[model samples]
Target: MAEALVDLLAKVRERSRGLLLRLEGRYTVVGDLHGDYATLQRVLNEWPPPYLFLGDYVDRGDKGLEVVEEVFRLLLEGKAAVLRGNHESPAMNVDGGFLDELCEKLGRGCGAVYKEFEKTFAALPLAAVVNGKVVALHGGIPLGENMRPAPLNRLATLEGDLTIPGDPLAFQILWNDPCNCDDYLPSPRGPGAWLFGREITKTFHALHNTRVVVRGHTYVSAGCATHHGGSVVTVFSSTAGPYRKTKPKIAVVSDGVEVFDLYTKSRAACPEDVDLLL
Candidate 1:
């Protein structure tokens, strides 16, 4: 409920945030919300705050405004932060219909209303370091100027405004995917999104001195999935849009990653099943 979110919208305007967040302690890694307010409420009720929301809060479903507002409210509360997802940007919003949905609600006032949302989206961090162990983000590692995996520290320099349409590190961080392949492959999601391989994840771990990467973007029917032999985990939190009827999941990061079934309300089995990029 976040106290209806209207009372907090004004507060959101007064706020500005960072590009990369360093978070400690245990927090639940919630995946792409995609406007499923019902599922978001369920996650909060079950798991509570101290959450890392891998973005895409809007688009491709109803209740986008509610989801975004609730997320903004949580950020204002100081216990949670969201990573920018590709869908959080302008192109995807226009494609995914969130802009139109927002337009219908605000009409001629759309510019002002959307600007607040846009500014908030622009300020969303691109990545988070969880307890200095696992790396959680909306997507996979970004390629450097040499078209290779960039230095881990480069994340802090990213201006994650969600409007960089080129192959910039921030854009890749929000759009890339990890795959079973041996190296990087051009993502069918199109230009900026690349499908990275096991070595990429392995090298990423070594370079960052981190153990694993937890991310969201692609949908997995089981609600949770492990790629590159458990080095990369993807969790999906919404059962709406194209992911309907599937189990929505959250990866709880504590001493280790524990996948929770939002639909079944139970701890999920370790999933080796690949998502096939569906």
Candidate 2:
């Protein structure tokens, strides 16, 4: 069993390396990783590019450094890109014990990794426009009427200055989640704000002429959710288990959308049972 797992990791590393040389399509979407290096390894190994990691690569699990290194390589080698998540720019420094624990796991010799993670976080975009058909972000759209593509373009190529507008689009990009309506709700995490509803997502799709707004932030144990006639599909890659007992899932996008549950080793089309959001 040990040998098989090692072989799997090696193959994944090779496949990730292959991404350096070539890629196709505008992008492939990844759900929240939550620092699961094993799942991240399997994803890179099993899937091809071009792919976009929807963020939350750190915290909530072990091997955060491994996750960071693989993704950093992918970004530097042009195999993939990333968007910011709440975890990447968490609400408070007081809540980062997990990051410190990750540091411990990676050990004291990993000062370079610590620096690398900081750099990677600095580079992550708040959003991306793919094939002009999809607008993706770590979270859904934010509140306010002035939201536009300019912010997304700016975010995609973010640089040195970390600016926060009173209505900073970056904050919304990482914190927004479409809920029942267009309203600002007090952030459960405190100091932060939460904007819930489909208005911004709809505006984004229409503004960009994209059909879907893809996101990750809220956890979906079943993998993903599609709303507003597929206008938005929120995906969660981290499986609903503490660790090894449950299998991770992938949000497979093609003609429409499907969930490939690693646990069941089965593929199912988008849920037909749920109501398409307003």
Best by TM-score: 1
The C-alpha lDDT values of all candidates are 0.78, 0.57
| TM-score of each predicted structure versus truth | 0.91, 0.73
Q: Which ten residues in a row have the lowest lDDT in candidate 2?
A: 15-24
- Cα deviation of 276, candidate 1, in Å: 4.0
Task: Judge candidate 1 at residue 65 and give its lDDT.
Answer: 83
Residue-level lDDT of model 1, residues 34-60, one tens digit each, is: 999999999888887798899889998
For model 2 the TM-score comes to 0.73
Candidate 2 runs further than 4 Å off: 1-26, 90-98, 106-116, 145-151, 154-160, 163-167, 182-192, 240-247, 253-259, 263-266, 269-278
Backbone clash total for model 1 is 0
